[model samples]
Each structure stands twice: as structure tokens, then as C-alpha cells.
Target: MDIRVKFLGGAKSVTGSKYLITVNDFHVLIDCGLFQGLKQLRLRNWDDLPVNPEKIDCIVLTHAHIDHSGYIPLLYKNGFGGKVHCTEPTLELADILLTDSAKLQEEEAEFANRKGYSKHNPAKPLYTVRDAIEALNILEAHPFDLTFRIHNQIEVRFFHAGHILGAASIELIIYSSQGIKRMVFSGDLGPMHNPLHFAPVKPPNADVLFMESTYGARRHKDVDLEKELRQLILESDKKGGCILIPAFSVGRTQLVLYYIWKIFQNMKSRPVYIDSPMAISVTHLYKSFSNYHRLESDSEFGHHIFDAPFVHYVTEQSKSKVLNTIKDRAIIISASGMATGGRVLHHLFHRLPREQDIVLFTGFLPEGTRGRDIANGEKLVKIFGEEVMINAKIHVLDGFSAHADQDELVEWSGHISEPPKMTFLIHGEKEQAEVLRERLIGRGWNVTIPDYLETFTLFDHV
Candidate 1:
């Protein structure tokens, strides 16, 4: 029994989320995600594939989040013809996200070529949108909570992660001559009371577990996020200020709009503009699978918060410029949540330096992102290759975070069915990971924080 688990990404830093496992000659790559953040992390995507894609037997995804699924187009482009397994909702979301990501890369490359900013003479995209579409055609859908065999010796199953619409925590069982080897990969854990989704299921018993520690170190603020959303919109409208919120296109955007709908339920009038074209379409995709959401059928919430009026879809440069004339009295929710890319950059260029306007951050901003800099109170910043002074009244409501808090993680894992032999923490900063490790150890679990690219043998009886 030779089982080697390699932490390719998402170990120490929170960006790229790749992990590879090998049992004899059978190769399985858990994720082949893009490394996002500063240039150092982003450069990893440009390098050659870590392993020969042809030799990999299968690729299983935990969820559709870009850090976990971004590089699928690149994988397919690099000659990985294997089956990619995920839930049905995850497949739909990935279909939207991967195509959009490839298009964005092409757009970026074109922009770079025009502006002469890129080192490449004619700036080529990492992978084209066609590559993403090709990858999408090969997707294999598997339902949650069902155990299915992949090979003679390996079985794979997924449990609902409750993090987003179709998130999951993966469990793998490999039969060896000595005994059975069980491993669990806990994807991004959702909060206890997520606005639209149900709480995640209990962790299953296993010999090894890979858990995320994104929110390990801190506790979120106790505030009714709905109330806060109402107040923010009212105050900004009264002051004739355009409120800008940079949000992720998928789960975070949907949650924010749900709160927006909550506020509008009481308001008499308002003009809200959802600028990102990707978000508008993704919102529709979200509705197509609305049955997967807990709140879609809830009596207390409207079924179509995404279809609210005053929400204009902005895609082209000309249409986006129309927002400039929008009299500083409307709400604008744009994308590239971390202020990293997308149309949000143009919005921030104007809004950030305006004292009357407001910029609201809703998602987790990693260390090197522009969103983190603004949230942390950096005075002057760069946008679209120009330095701009910070004048917008930046408001960061800590309650808007999407991940589960420290107590939630502990409480959820503490009451699992079977205790794990060893736990490895990933997708967290050092401070957060270390604190969570100590706290988990206090509860009497064998926890190991694996270093980046660390390798560990699963069975001792090899």
C-alpha cells in the first residue's frame, strides 16, 4: 500500500487550491486551480503543468470557486482528457465560471497587447474560451451522499459542504492489502446560518482529513446583515453618493442581492444597478438551479431577488460609461471581488477618490489584493496603472464575510461521527491556521499543518 498525498496548492496561502494523490501507478489530482494574488502566486499558473496531465486518472472538484476550479481550461489545453467529477450544480457553475475566466484572460491579453504592458509581444491568453468549453463537454456529474467506485481499489463520495450553492466535502476510500485508507477534504466551510443555503453536514470518520482554515483566527461581528444593508443604501442615497460594492460573481453576489431585496422590501423607491454582465447571467444560472438553495422556497424571502428592477446589466465599455452619468445616487455592484480585475477597476478609479461616495467590501480579500489595501486604510492607491487618492468613505461590515467563524468550525467538526487520525489545515494564513490547530488539539484530535507542497504517506504498511 503506497499512498502519497501531495499538497500542490492551498496549503499555507489561500489562493491556488491543488492537491494530488497517487496510489501505485493510478494518479488522481484533487484540484488544478490557478494561483491568484501577487505576481509571485499568479506566475505559478504560467509555468508548465506540475505533472503530466495525460497520466492523471481522474480530477475531482470540491466546488466551483475559482481558486479551486480556475485552471481547468489550462488543464484541458495541456492535454488532460480525463473525466472531471462534481455535483450537477457545480458543473453548471463551473461551466459559467471557466468560460468567463478564459474570456477575461483573452480580454486581458488583448488589453495588454494594446497598452504594451505585457512582456509578450502579442500577449497570448493562458487558455482560450474554446478550451474551457471543450473541458465543459467532458464533465461527469455525480450526486451527493452517494458512494461510487472509480476503480477496482478506489471509491469516491461527496457530502454537501453548505459553503455555496453546490459546494462539497470530498471523501475517498482506497482498499489496500493491509486495510482501507480513508481521506476527507473539507472544502470551504459555510457559515451556520447562511442566507440562502442550509448548514453543511457532519464530517465523516476517516483516517486523514484536509480542512480549510480561512476564518480560523477571528470571530465575525454580531449584526443583522439585512439591517446593515438597508442603512448603507439609505445613507448613501440621501447623500447622493454612488455606493460601490465589489463582490464575487457567484455566491457572494447572490447573498448581497438577497439582502438588497430585503432592504427594498421596505423601501418605497431605489435605483440599483448590477453592472457586471457575468453577474447578471450568473444570477440567472443561480435561479435555474434555485431549487438547490434553502431560501428559494422559503416563505419569508422573495423567490426572485435577482430579478429586481433598477438592476441594470452593464457589459460593454460604452454601457459601463453610462454609470458615470448616474448622478451619484444609485447602487453599483461590480465584480472581481478582491478589486483584482474585471469592470470593478474602472468603477473604483472614479469612486475611490470621491469623498462623497462609498466603497463597500463584501468578500475575503487576500494579502496582496487592492481590496485588502483599501479595507486596511491605505490612503492613496493605484488603479488601472494610475495612482488615485483614497477619499471614498470605505465601510467594511465584518458581518458580510461568507465563511464560517471560528466557533462554527470547531462546533461543526467536534460533533462528527468518527474522529479522524490526522487533520491537515489549508486555505488560511499562518496566524489563523496556527490558532485553529492549537484549538483543535485542545479537543484531542491529531492535527498536522502541512507545509506548501508537503508529501505524506497515508498507509504505514506499505
Candidate 2:
């Protein structure tokens, strides 16, 4: 059998992570993520895949991040009818994220049509809620470390990736007529020092490896997170202004809450409002799956970290809208971390023009995202099809990122006892991927950075 690998997405970009592995007539897809960030990349979501979705046999998910698992609904709508395999927590998280994703798209499309700002005459959502529900019905949950068979010649196992609650790096054992080979996919490895997660598990021996390079070009700065958060909060409070945090609902939001809780314990605490409904739901999962993370204990205040008196969960649209009227002494946390879409946009539309308010971002912002533009000090940002002045104090706290940095990535790669025949770096921008490729080469490992839709032969007549 001839084996080949193709990069359908996540080639030289951080978003839309999909990879296709083919062994003769059998086909398996790893990750069916949506393309985000730049307009050109987002347009790819409307384009047809080179291969028919129905032709793909199965899908294996690495995590539940939108960029990693958001495209399943669209694929299901387009004719993909295969089982989606992932860890039990991943399955649960994906259901929430995918449903939210569909709702956002539908809402955006309807708004665009009403406003007549979209180029398309009548904007339409890529997929609907029904599609997402249908796609989710096919998901098959599995536990980490248990070997399972997807095909007669292929066996699969999962290792702790430490990125999120159930994120995992996958190992595939393929048995062919000629011999046996192992292929490993390093799915979004988390930082070694993340408070909520343990360190990523080292990779077992492999003949082929695909690793993530999200932060390959730089290292995370060592800073006192508590001190920085305290200063920001104090400064905002002194100005009699609210601090708006655009954090990812999955990991970053929870981490930010933990740090804020610590800071509140030592000082006067302001009301912290979590404005995203999805984030509120995701936070509750930490309680359900105690073994998945390290936040099982209560805080020094004798309450669950998320159950503090000053912390408020906003669920209703009416309550969320009321928060827009507040102008001082509050910390509002919202979703769509990049400010691509979500309730955060409404908050941004109202607060960006206020010089006293602070808009704080807690993670990586990809190219062409509104969060990146604001963080880059753009004076004006368009919101709701209208130009809005950006007078708010903009800040980015990189220490809160969940992805592993250059040193951590190198350390993770070094855990492999022997170098693979070839290592392809995926899930990073061009410059970052190239930097990682050079670094690995210095360590006596062969590395290649694949471009979008590129294909490479892994074995011949195996």
C-alpha cells in the first residue's frame, strides 16, 4: 500500500487545522477545523474542498477549539457521514463550541442582511444549528491511553497534550503487508507551566511526526502574572473605568478568572462579570471532570474559585445589554477572544471610544483580526458597519497564552528518543514555522514546513 499525507489546512497558518492521510483506497482525516483570521483565509470556508467529504472515511479530533474542530457541521451538511472520534471531554466541549459557532454565523448573516453591508445580496450562514446537532450525533468518545482500531491495519492511541481539558496528541500504528510504522500528530501542545494542566506527555517512538509550532519563533516572557493583573485592575479602577477582557471561553477565560481570584484575595475586589453564556457553561465542566484539570480545590476564600461573591455570570441578553451602560469600576469578560464575533463586539462597540476604559486581550491574535489591529494601536476600528474611535487603553497579556513557546516546544520534541524519518511542522504562520524548522535542523532533525494543500509521499508499497 502507498501512504501519503496532505495538508488541506493549517499548512503555514495557525487557523483551520485539517490533514488528510491516505493509505491506498482507505482515507482518514485528522481535524476538521474552520479557517479564521484573515479575510482570504476565512473565504476558504465558502470554497469547496478538493476532496469530496463523503469520500473521507473517518475523522479524528485533537481538541475542541473552533480553529481545530468547528468545521464538522459544514462537512456533515456537505455529505460527510463518518464517525468523529475524540476524548470524552473533547466530545462534550466540541458540542458546545460547534453549537455556539453555528449560532454566531447565523446571527452575523442575519445582521449583515439587515444592515446591507455584506457584498452578498442575502448573506447566509455556512451551516445551521440543526447541522451542528446532526454532526455531533455521530461523535464517538474514547478515553486517553486506550488503544483502539479504526481500520483493520490501523490502531490509535491518545496521549495528554495539556492544551485544554481533553486535548490530546495522537499516535497511529499502521500495519501493512510489508511492515509496521508509527505516525504521531502533536495536537496543539500546551505550555509546561500552565496552572490548570499538567505537562504534556512525551511522544513515544515514531517513524513519522507532525508537530505544532504556534509559538516556535519566540519564547514566553516570565512575569509575575498576579502582579501584572493587579496593576491593570488597580489602574483601571483608579480611572473609575471598567476593564474589558476579551478571552477565549475554553482555557484562557478560566485561567484569567483564577488569577483575578488570587488578586482579589489580597485587595479590594470589583464586580467581575462573565458575559459569555458559552463560557459560563464551559466553566461548569471543570467541576464535572475533576480528573481532566487541577482546579478541584476551593480558593482561600472558602469558595469554589468560580463561585466567588463578586463574580457574576451573565446569561440573559437583557442582562448582558445592561452591562454596556456601566462605565466604571467593573471587570467585564467576554468571548470571541480575537474580537472576530460574539457579545464582545457589542461591548467593544460601546467601550472602545471611552478613554477611561481598558480593553485587555489575554492571548495570541492572528493577522487581520480586530483584536490584533487594536493591539497594534490602530486609532479607528469599524464595528457594526460603522467606524469607531479606539480611545480605550489597549493591553495584551501574552503570559496568559496556552500554547507552548519556542523553548517549551523544543523541550517537547527532545522527548522523542529518536528522530523520525521526517518531521513536518504544521499550525503556525510562515515565519514561525520556518524558525522552528531551522531550530530543529540545528538539533540534527530533518524538518519540513508544508504549504496549504501540499502533499507528500510517506511510504511506497509498504
Candidate 3:
């Protein structure tokens, strides 16, 4: 029997995570995610998978982040009808993200066609909201730590990865004619000191390991993120200008809101508003899965994570548009963290020219993104075909990132009982992966920085 693994998407880049694992007569895909950032990478979303999706038996999602689980709907649309195994919170959050993704694609396509900016005669969405719902229906929810059988020859388990609400590291025990071998897939591992979720759990013994290196190249700077946020709010208020936060609706948005609610629960001047409908819905999901969070869901502080004296949720387009007209010193949090797309762009267009306002980023902004460009001090940016001056103060609060840093990743890897036979680093850019490869090598572990569509045989031939 031959057992092989393929690095589909998240090999040399930080986005679009898809891993295909093939065992004798059975095929399993892990982490069907969409690519973001550069136009070339984003274009890969429209490209067909290396293998036919119809032939795949099942998909195992690591988390609910768009880069880790966003491509499932597209896979389903391509004829994959098998079960998508994930934690309950992951399943629920996937529903929110995938649905929102489909809607966003449709909206972008419609806008492109109307504006005649697209090369195609009529721009088309990759998938529809109906397709997203179809994919969401097939998710099979499982709990962490419990071993379950996905096939007669394959057993699997989920460990807390701590990146998001239900992020997990997957352990697969594959039975072959030679013997049983374990393969561990570390999804996006969160920081050890994450305020919202617990640290990533240690992996059990394994023969092969696939790990993420999103922050492999550098250590996160020591900064008081909450304090910075509070200070920014106060400064913006003092200047009578709004503070705009472009956050990923899933983990970052919720975390930012949690910190805001905690820091300014008693403050009356900083009126906070969640302007993205998708983020508002995702925030509600955090309440539903109270046990998944580190804090007590029902406690006075915990129960009000999303509540502030003047906090508002702008669910309708009309209400969101009204925010652009308000010159008050309010805090607005919107989605599409990198400012790739979404209501956040509208806010950026309206507020970027205002010298007193501040544009704050609470998460990673990949290269080539508008957020990165502005963060890098680009003076002029095109929003809706109009050049907008970046007069607003650009601030990056790196302490809010969810991914584990270099030292923390090394610490996590040290938890393995023994060094695995081999480790393949994925989910990071080239320099980051190479830097981590060198670090892991120093610790006496063999590591490979895989390329996109690379393949490796996991089992020895007889």
C-alpha cells in the first residue's frame, strides 16, 4: 500500500491551505482554504485543483478561518459531496465564513461587471451562497480528544490548536499492510498567551508532522495591545476623529471587541460600532459556544464581551453608509482584515483623507494588500478607482495576532515526545519557512519547506 501526501495550496505562501493525503484506495483532503493577498495568489482560487475534487473521499478542516477552511464551498461546487470533519465550533464558524465568502465573491463580481473593470465580459462569482450552504450541510462535528474512525483503515483525533474558537491540530492514525503510522497536522497554532483561547495542546507521538510557520521568521514584539487600543481610542476622541479598524471578522474582530469591551466598559466617550454584518453574526456565535472560550461566558465581564454602553451593530447597508458621514470620534471595526475587500474599504475611502483619524490593523496584512501598502506608508491608494490620500495615521498592533511566534513555535515543537521522522513546514512565506527550517534543524529535527503542488511519500516501499 502506498501512502503519500501532497502540498496543494499553503506551501510557500501564508494563505490558501489545502493538503491532500492519499492512502491505499482512499483519499483525504485536509484544510480546504482560499488564497488571499497578491493578485496571482488570489487568481489561484479560480484555478482547478491539481486533482479532481469528485474523486476525494472526505475533507478534514483544521479551523474556520477563510485561509484554512474557506475553499470547501468551491470544492463542493466541483463535485465533492463527502463529509467535512471538524470541531463543532469550527463547523458553526465555517458556516458563517463560507456563507459570507460566497456573498462577497458575488458582490465583487457584480461590482466588477457594473464598473467594467473586469477583463471578462461578465464577471462571475466562484461560488454562490447556495453552494456555501450546500457545503455547510455536510460538515460532521466531532469533539476534541476523542478518537474516531473516518474510514476502516484511518482513525483521527482533534487537539486544541487555540488559534480560534475551534481551531485544532489533527492526528491521523493510518493502518497499512506494513504497520500503523501516525501523521500530525498542526493547523494554525495560536500564541501561548492568547487572551481569548487556551494555548495549543501538545501533539501525540507521530511518524510524520505537518506544521504551520506563519510567524516563523521573527519574534512578536512585546507591546501592550490593549493599552495601545485604549490610547488610540482616547487620542481619536480627543481629536474628534473616528478610528477605523480593518479586522478579520473571525478571530481578530472578536478578540478586538473583547479587549475593547474589557478596557472601556465604563468609558462613555469611545462609542464602538461593529459595521460588518458578517462580523456581527460571528460575534454572536462566540456566545453560543461558551465552553470553547477561555473565559466564563455567563460572568459579568464575559457576558458583556460584545456589549458597551454606546456600542452599536450596523447590520444594514443603509446604516453602514451613515457611518461614513459621522465625523465623531467613534471606533469602527469592519471585516476583510487586509482591506482586500469588504465594507472596510468603504470606511478607508471615507476616512483615509482625514488627517486626525487613525487606521488601525489588528492582524497580519500580507504583501501586496492595500492594508500593507498603507501600513508601509503609501501616500496614495486607489479605492473605487479614485486615488485617496492616506492622511490618516496608520497603526499596526502586532500583539493582537493569533499565530504563534518563533520562540513560541519552538516551544510547541519541543513538546513532541521525540522528534518525528520528518516535518514539512507549510502556511508561511518563503523567508519565514526557510528561517523556521533552520531553527528546527538546530534542534535536531529534519524539516522540509515544501513548494506548491509538491509531493512526498510517507511510507517506505517494500
Candidate 4:
């Protein structure tokens, strides 16, 4: 018997997570995510999978983030027919995200064609909404902690990773020729104290461990979240200027809303508008899956916290456009957290030049994104082929991040009952992964930092 794993993506980068595991003749792909940020990385989305999509037996999704689960639609569009197993909340959010992804693809293609900026004769979307719906049809939702068999020789269990509402860490056990082997994949561990979600579950003992190193080299700054938020809100309110926050629709958006509800419940507050339709829909799911969050009762707090009077949902495009025309003091939260694409870009185009306005970021911005450029104090940024001056006061609230920090990740990895024979550090930049490798080696753990497309034999016997 022989078993091996290959890194199709997410080796020394923060996006495009894909791993292929082969057990003799059987195959399973885990976390079929889309590449984002840099053009070189994003172009990989159009490249054919290392293995034929049709040959794959199943897809074990980690979560619903674009970088973790975005490529499912494209896979379906090509040729893949198998079960996509995930948490119930992931299924719901994926339905929304994939559809939105398809829409954005089509919109981007159309914009390129109209502006004659694309190299292609006629820009075409990689996949359509129909493809996304087709992908959504194959999703099979499972409850956490239930051991389910994907094939006669393989079994998997989903444990809470706490990065988002339905995020999970996967435990896989395979019966191979050498013997039974255990492998664990830390999908994306959450911080120790998330406001809306629970802390990540400690990983069970395994022969092989695949861990994420997204924040391996850095720790998030400890700041008074409410105080910073209050200061920004009051300053913006005083100037009669709007505060625009570019947040991820799934986890970060809801966290910001929760914080605002807590901070401004008694004081006179500005009307808060959720400008992304997908976020509006996802917030309702947060209520539906109250068991996954830190809330006591879904029914009691759902209306009070999420559906508050001050919170407004802008679902229509015309209504979203109207937000740009407004000059009053309000809090507008939009999507594509990194300002890569979405309504947030348009908000940035409108509000970035306003000295009194504020643009707040509550998430991590990858190195090549416009969000990072602005965060790094780039005075001039490009948006939609137009140069946009960055005059708006820029601020970041790292406390709202979904990924665990370096110390938190080390602490989470310490929970394994016994040290694994081999542990792979993945899902980060090369520098970040190396820093973590050194830290883990100092702790007497055997760690390997794999390169892109590298393969390793996990179990072998003759």
C-alpha cells in the first residue's frame, strides 16, 4: 500500500489553497480555493488542475472564503462530479459567495470589454452563475464531530476551527498498506478570543499534520477596540463625513456589526449601512446558525444585534450607488475585504479624496492588493483604470481579523496530544513560513516547508 500528498497550491502563499491526496488508485482534493491578489497568482485560476478534475473522487472543503473554496464553480464548469462535503453554514455561505463570484467575473469581463483594456479579443467569464449553481448542488453538509466515510478506505471528521461561522479543521484517517494513518489539516485557525465565534478546537493527534502559517511571523497589536472605533466614529460624525469600511462579507462584516451594536447602543450613533447584498444575506445566516457563534439565543439577539433599526441593508445596485452620493455621516460597510473587487472599490473611488472621510480596514490585506498599497501610505492608487488620490484618513483595526496570530497559532498547535512524525507548514509567504519553521524547530518538532507542486509520501509498505 502507498499514500502520498501533493501541494497543488497554497504552498508559500496566503491564497489558492489546494491539496491532493492519493491513496493507491483513489484520489481526493482538499480545499479547492481560487488564487487571489497578485496577477501571477490570480492567473493560476485559469490553469488546468494538476490532476484531471473528472478523475477526482471527492472534494473536502475547509471553509467558504474565496481563497479556500472559490474555485469549486470553475471546477464544476470544467468537469467534476463528486460530493463536496462541508459544514451546513459553509454550504449556505458558499451558495452566496459562488454566485457572487460568478457575477463579479461576468461584470469584470464586461467592464474590460467596454473599456478595451483587456488583451483578450472579447473577455469572457471563467464561469457563469449556472456553473456556480451546479457546483452548489453537489454540496453535502455534515455536522461537526461526526466521522463520515468518503470511500471504503477513508474516513473524515470536521472539528470547529472557529475562523468563521462554519469553518472547520479536518481529521482524516486512511487505511493504507503500511497500516492505518492519521492526517490533520488546520483549515484556518481562529484567534483565542473572537467576539462572535468560538476559539479554534485543538487538533487531535495525527501521524501527519498540515497547519496554516498565515500569521506565523507577526502578532496582532492589542488595542482598545471600542476606544479606537469610538474615536473614528465621533471624528467622522463631527466632520459630517462618512466612514467607509472594507470588510469580508462572511466573518469580518458580522464582527464589525456586533462591535458597533455594542459600542453605540446608548449613545447617539450614525446609521450603519451594509452595502453588500451577499453580506446582508450572510448576516441572516449568522442568526440561523446561532449555535456556531457566541450568542445565547438566536431568536432573542438576532433581531436586537443584527436587525437593529440603525442597521440598513443595501441590496439593490441603484441603492448601493446612492451611498456614494451621500454626504452625511454614516457607517458604510462593503465587501471584497482587500478592496480587490466589489462595491467597496467604488466607495473608495468616491470617498478617498475627501479629507474629512475615513476609510477603515478591519482585515488583513495581502501584499499586492490595493488595500495594502493604501495601508502602506501610497498617496496615489489605481482603481478601475483611474488614478485615485488617497486623501481619506486611513486606519486599520487588526483585532477584527479572522486568522489566528503567531502566538495563538503556536498555542493552538500545542494542543496536539502527541508530536506528529512530520508536520508541514503551509498557507503563508515564504518569509512568514520560515519564521514559524524556526520557532517550531526550537520547540523540538520536525517541520517541513513545502514548495509549490511538491509531493511527499505519507505511508508506504511493500
Best by TM-score, which number? 2
User: Per-candidate TM vs. native?
Assistant: 0.96, 0.98, 0.97, 0.98
What residue runs in model 3 are displaced by over 4 Å at the alpha carbon?
Answer: 265-267, 298-300
Q: CA lDDT of each candidate?
A: 0.83, 0.92, 0.88, 0.90
lDDT of 4 by residue, 1-462 (tens): 678899988999999999999888888998999989888998998888888899889999989998989999888877888989999899999999999999999999999899988889799988998889888999999999999999898999999999998999999998755567899999998998987889998888899999999999989889788788988998998777999999999989988988898888668877899999889999889878878888765344354688788899998998999999888689999998999999999999999999889999998898888899999999999998899999999998888889998998899988886888899998998888999989888888999999989999987772
C-alpha lDDT (0 to 100) for residue 420 of candidate 2 = 91
C-alpha RMSD by candidate, in order: 1.7, 1.1, 1.4, 1.4
Q: Which candidate model has the greater lDDT, 1 or 2?
A: 2
Ranking by TM-score: 2, 4, 3, 1
What does the lDDT read for residue 23 in candidate 4?
A: 85
lDDT of 1 by residue, 1-462 (tens): 688888888888887898888988888888668888877888888887668888888899988888999988888888888888998888988988888888889988898888788888999988899988988987788988998887799999988888887888899999987778888888888888887777878887778888899988888878888888788877887777889999988778888888887777788646777778778777877667766777654466756566667556777878887786666778888898899888899889888878779899986789888899999999988875679999999988767676888888888787666668778888887788899999999988888888777899876655
Put down candidate 2 lDDT per residue, 270-335, tens digits, no spaces: 899999999999988877887888765653522288888899999998999999999899999999
Q: What is the model-wide C-alpha lDDT for candidate 3?
A: 0.88
Over 1-462, each residue of candidate 3 has an lDDT whose tens digit, in order, gives: 788998889998999999999987689999999999889998999898999988899999899888888899889888997999999999888888889999999998999899988898799998999999988888999999999998998999999999999999999998867788999999999999987888999888878889999999989999887788888888888778888999988878888877887777556546788989888887888788888877676676584767656679999998899999889778899988899889998999999999889999887788879989999999999887679999888998989999999898888888888899999999999999899999999989989999899999888651
Candidate 3 local lDDT, residue 330:
82
Stretches of candidate 1 exceeding 4 Å from the true structure: none
Q: Quick one: ranking by lDDT, best first? A: 2, 4, 3, 1
lDDT of 3 at 412: 89
